[model samples]
Target: MSLKVKFDELKTLAGTELGTSDWIAVDQDRINTFADATDDHQWIHVDVEKAKTGPFGGTIAHGYLTLALLIPLWTELLDVEGVTTKVNYGLNKVRFPAPVPAGSRIRVTGKLGDVEEVPGNGLQLTADLVIEIENGTKPACIAQPVFRFYA
Candidate 1:
């Protein structure tokens, strides 16, 4: 279920599991677009046929590509209604534990963490995030993303 929280409620929810995002397909097209955008056309990520012989056994999504998807995925999980604006502060930690192969589906699960006040009537929100690959034993990515929300 989608959770809507106000500023105070957000603080209270810290350390609680948020929710999971809808499954998203990491297809060749999306991977190619990311490659073009970031100029990261590594054979293992953009070259499908050739990647069959490479590591991971096939084309895989760029680790950053998967991390970038967290924006939309986060929106699907929770909504902070009283914020005037929200900004991506930065990540505290990140890791890729498993490869996200092309044609695979993935989703993110998050938990609220620390919440601290920032300058100019803003709040810095932190969360522990994990991106899960469908049927995979290990998570594709783990991250702690911090966001600044202003009222």
Candidate 2:
């Protein structure tokens, strides 16, 4: 479930654990679509046959694919009311610690790190996020994403 809050209340939630998103499967079809869009058809990501003999023992989703999934997963975790606009400012840090094999399930958990005022009549939110693969040994991605909510 998402944490629904008003824009003005965001600051009060700093340092709070926002919670985890619902798990989504990273199937080959989605991986192929991302590969097509990004022109990143690396063997380990799309070449299922060859990838079977490659590292990870199967086809894996591209690192960026996992990173991109953060957007939808993030929206599932937080919903801010009373904002004119919401923008994904950018990421401060990102790391892919583990591969997400095709067909694997992934979910994200986040903590509201900081809430500060920005120049454009906006509130800047920094969230520390972790994307974990179900039953995997290590997290699929670790990222610090910044968001801006304008009044």
Candidate 3:
């Protein structure tokens, strides 16, 4: 579903649970691509042979790779309507609480924590996002992502 809140109306959503996203897989290829792009080809992330004896028993996705996935993963959660522009402001807090193995699926649940007016005709929103990995006891990541919506 879509979020019907306008730029100014976002303030009304403070302290509310906004939306939850659909599950997205964290496959080996995607993990490898992230390792390649970031030049962080750690054996645990890229070398299956070496990772077999590693701590996780097999290759585990890089923490940052899972963090980066939040962008596309958020798309399944909700759509914004009636906003002229939306910009990622930054993150407040972020943590990788669990390892994400390749082939695992993940999803995000977002809560609207804060909303404020900016200098221009823009609204700033801070959302607490928790990304859960299927079958994992701990969430893959917990973060507070901020965004600005200009009308």
Q: For this target, which candidate reaches the highest lDDT against the unseen true structure?
A: 2
Our tally of clashes for model 3 stands at 0
Worst 10 residues of 3 by lDDT: 1-10
Candidate 1 pairs with clashing backbones: none
lDDT of 1 at 13: 79
The models' CA-based lDDT, in order, is: 0.91, 0.96, 0.83
Write one digit per residue (lDDT tens) for candidate 1, span 45-150.
9888899999789999999999999898888888998888989989999999999999999999999899888898888889999999999999999999999888
Clash counts per candidate, in order, are: 0, 0, 0
The TM-score that candidate 1 achieves is 0.96
Off by over 4 Å in 2: none
Q: Candidate 2 has what TM-score? A: 0.98
Clashes of 1: 0
